[model samples]
Target: MELYQLRTFVAVARAGHLTRAAEGLHVSQPAVSAHIKALEDELGVALFTRSARGMGLTPQGQALLARAQSVLEQAEELTRAARSLRQQLDGELKIALNTDAEFLRVRELLSVLRAEHPALGVHLPQNMSHFIAEEVRAGSLDGGFVYGEAPPQGLEAVPLCSFRLVVIGPLAWRERLAGATWADLAREPWVWYSDALPCHASVQRWIAPYECRLSKVAVTDYEGTIRALVQSGAGLGIMREDEGARCEGAGEAFVWRGDSLPMNAYFLYRRDRESDPAMRAVLAALRAVWGLEQPLASAHMRA
Candidate 1:
């Protein structure tokens, strides 16, 4: 009946697990369960079917989910309208960062935002790029930096920059990998990224024409872990061009001179919130920091 209960219901429905929904809502599992139970009792119908696997929305729940979501959107719109009337922009904006703060220019971005809207607070949560996109689309995050060929549907993205991914190996492997071709590189032991990462797909596509299977020794999503493993001679890894150059310059890793995979980084937010003042403020700061011109009407996607 309350907005919190509806929010919990939507979160649980999307997550399909009590613990995950609780974590997303920043509440305890018991609290989430109680909210669902209370809502079901008040509505006189079962919202979800519980089992060992996870919660599944019942027929009625599925039908009402859209309505509940609409209600939440309306409530948020009302809040935004009220805040817009205030002389100063003041609220907490949660943004997700997919990489190190320095590379993202987060410090500079924050400084600009603070100077422009002193009352506005920002929260930077580090996460994977895809997860950041999902959270932004779901309205859990205000905006974030994501790396991909294009932003996901329902989101507007401003192109920030691009980086090429280069293959890197331990310093000891330099002699072994000297003048190595794609086929030769494929034969080497690899420290691969998780399939969930955007770079994983890029790597896969990049190597597809080579038609070779990699000997994966380890799999991880963290760039730091990949760098460390590669440095310790665990295997080869795909790293950003600048990072690979830094490691190579430090004599820690060897960067392959072969064709590199190119990727674009974007600042993404829910397309529906483009007109919101707070979102506009953040976007303006991002543009200034990235030295980008005024975004075109369709700049959200590259031609």
Candidate 2:
């Protein structure tokens, strides 16, 4: 029932292991168990079902978890609200991003938000797609920018932009095989991204027919690092067009623009706290800055 207990519950839900969650909270496993027990007793429902592997949320646990998270979020907001009683919009906004490249749109959005809502403080953290979505759902992050196939469960998605992937490589290497299909590219040494990323999954599918035989000499999880490595003569790699352009002049970076891959960037917000003024302003700023080509409805279909 206490705020700290709710936090413990949320962490346990996310980690799916009481011991791991306890470690993350820097507390003993007993303490974590006590907190969950207290919470479940107060609610008169079983919050989790435990097995040898870890913990899993029961149907009732899922429902209460959502409500508990919202309650904890609002409790923190109340503390901030008391301090900002003199102003309506003065508060910190924590936003998480899936990648560093997302800064392109974030910068444009923040510029307008700062101009109009000067009292609002903004904090941005760039992370992988899944992590960003997890933070948003846990209420640690107010909202976030994630680019991928779909939103994580329990979060709402708003399309910001739709872009495709391109293969970039050193000019000399590209010149050797200027117009290569997925099959042809499969024959060369390539830099592979980790499977956790959306782009990596796309690449796997694109080259699935060839069975990933294209010498994966180097493997990286970071887009920026992979781009840099590919430019440093590692091998051909996939990247967004704008990201490739930013490093084109410095490194051996050039977009092939031949492969048409679907990539959709979305703004994710917790469903329970979607009506917060800060979140609304951020959404408006995003749409205005991006000059959203079409309505969110249409964008969703293509995304």
> TM-score for every candidate vs. truth?
0.69, 0.63
CA shift of 88, model 1, Å:
2.0
Candidate 2 lDDT tens digits, 177-248: 777766777777778777767566766777676565778888877787887778788788888777777767
Show model 1 residue runs off by greater than 4 Å.
1-86, 295-303
Candidate 2: segments with Cα more than 4 A from true spot: 1-87, 101-103, 245-251, 293-303
| Residue 272 displacement (Å), model 1 | 1.6
> Candidate 2: deviation at residue 103, Å?
5.4
Error of 1 at 225 (Å): 0.6
lDDT of all predictions: 0.89, 0.78
